[model samples]
Target: MNPWEVASPCTQRCVTRPTGNEQAYARTRRVPAASVLRRYASLTAALGSALAAGTRIADPSVLQRHARCVLGALGIGLDATGPLRVPGTAAGTLIVANHVSWLDVIAVLAVEPVPLIAKQEVSGWPVVGPLTRRTGNRFINRDAPRELPRFVGELAAHLRDGGSVMVFPQATTWCTAPGGPFRRAMFEAALRAAAPVRPAAIDYARDGTRSTAAAYVGGDSLAASLLRVAGTDGLAVRVRPCRTLWPHGHDRRSLAAAAHAAVSDAVSAPVLAPRTGVFRTARPPEATVPPQLRAHA
Candidate 1:
């Protein structure tokens, strides 16, 4: 196994089943193919420029601007709400959010640029890989459960040194809002470092209505997802940060549950219902860890 591979409980089955092909087709309003091509071209240029600039630009504000520029090139608007920064006296904060699509990374960066804990495969993805590494994000190998403890320890140390981190506790992407349960492993690091946990919610919408056109679940390829996003008109991502949870008296499990509930509540609010049939009611199976691995995690 590759040393950097990460494990995830989510699979193709976790994807929400659409009512039917025709119904799903009628709901989305896609732009012309030429428009999609133009968007992709703009995105490519933006990424290239970012790569050329690379690590030379270490300022968070500059990085945030670049992220917003990338989103603009892709024709995706960002609406971030609530407190986006850590309190003045906080040593560091651990930001956790539900995973929906690959774009979640860029959207979060646009609001608050921070080091991310990403899966190893992300490091090999075209221009994005090189750019993310240059930004000093950490990658993990989920395949090696034994290394989890060391990784968590290092993360705690980083927090202790007053460095904030962003992580997707869902581990894998889901089709839409209220995705999957938060994993407890990363929460352990926050507890060890005495950092606050901030839960954020991310969802995509077309015009003013909720839309799943940007979901990257099932057997969907990155190229296919990117094209879908580019072809969609009036697409926007809404990011809402919930109240922070202190770790003074919380365990990893409790902290994880609290964060998950906060995010779920934030996203579960009533939005304009889709014109199509109802979303799937089934939930994905919970992730399981062995007793020995659980101790380290």
Candidate 2:
């Protein structure tokens, strides 16, 4: 029960204006031929180890540990400032992080083992796709907005069962230096399930300077990003754990704002844009509060 941790529930609010920055792009300088060769060999071996662990192991924790080792082998280092424990009540824990690049997923997974909420298309990616499913992730269809309610219901149920779910509230990827506003729809699920939102900030650096070599943004192909990342020297991913927030008395919008603020502050990124008062989906009647949280609500 740390006083600083902030956690989650859902809201029905949507963004009318686009709140993401399109100008930011991944930039990487050329490295020495020897450096690239060493990293390429390391990355190849890491990928093989990850695939073997994922296919051979059935335990989630074991698979995640192997995944973490793979990230280390690929030169992504973990720099959690404090104990990485996520705090919460009997209700489930919702772990939220800023979405910078595809590497953010691997970085978080390396730090903690939890089920992830990802887009349906990730399930079809070559080697990574099947591994994601085997690791116990839930996939949502980005094409069908109407099915969001169903997905929300499932998320709430997972929380009620005292499980932890990891999500990227930004809803899309941004450059390593910039981040988008947190979408509030997913907050409503936390509201219903009475889950705590754990905000985590992830950043990539090369030789101690912030680097965009890992950003997989606008029109950046997977192969291109991979090549740049593997060739970069002194590249590392840092995961900073922030305080957790609860959704007991607050509505979905306030909760989303709190979580977003925690992450924005942690990463030292400016608040890009506002997404308030935009009506997207009609809100359903307030869900019946559980007895444990009724007093706080």
Candidate 3:
């Protein structure tokens, strides 16, 4: 059996599609067709402008500004809590989040722009591919299990060199909260580098209620998802950064469990069952304080 076969799996079965009535409701909230077109145009212009500037504006703040502009063009707003960038640490921090939509990458960038771990296919994508490469993001080939150890080692080296990286531990997109289990392989990088792990919870909402308009799940094409996001009004992404976890005296499995619990609690989502036998111990006692208590404290 392939070693990577033991990794947690997330398939099309885990995706939750909106019902017919929910689809109708989304349509009602959609902007005019022309508005969507304009939004796309604006997004293109923003990407083009950023590309034209080259590495001169490669600063994280500049990248963050560019991301915000892209979101604004799509009529989406961003609300983030906690420190987007951990301060005073020379060691790179591993930023982990639950995956929901393609927009998640941009949403996270808007708050804190950093190179991310993406699937290898993203490197071949039209504009996004070139942009990601230009910005120093790394990609992994999910089909090539043999290459995973090498990739994880390189990722650890990067972190040890003080280069931060963001990754979606869910490994794939889900339609809503309480998504798939957090894969443990990526956490191994954090453990190897002795880097701190920062867990963030991401979700979409509109009119103060959870919204699935931005979800990009099974069978959802990129073009269709983009159009859906552009057409939706009052769409906003919420990023809540949880307490940072240190690797001292903890194994990768415990670290993954603790991070998963932190993100799940932050989004008010129930914790999903872990893959059988993958987690030998319960979530570590160092798990983050519940968001509600943290808020009052």
Which number leads on lDDT? 1
- The segments of candidate 3 whose C-alpha lies over 4 angstroms from its true place after superposition are 1-28, 269-297
User: Tens digit of lDDT per residue, candidate 1, span 108-166?
Assistant: 98888898999888899888889888888999887777888899999999887778999
Error (Å) of candidate 2 at residue 165 is: 0.9
lDDT for residue 192 in candidate 1, whole number 0-100:
85
RMSD of each: 8.7, 11.5, 8.9
Report the lDDT tens digits of candidate 3 across residue range 32-51: 98998899999999888778
Q: Number of the top candidate by TM-score? A: 1
Total clashing pairs for each candidate: 3, 25, 0
Alpha-carbon deviation at 249 in model 2, angstroms: 2.2
Q: Worst ten-residue run, lDDT, model 3?
A: 273-282
Q: Per-residue error at 63 for model 2, in Å?
A: 2.5
lDDT of each: 0.75, 0.66, 0.74
Candidates 1 and 2 compared by lDDT, better number? 1
Candidate 3, overall lDDT? Answer: 0.74
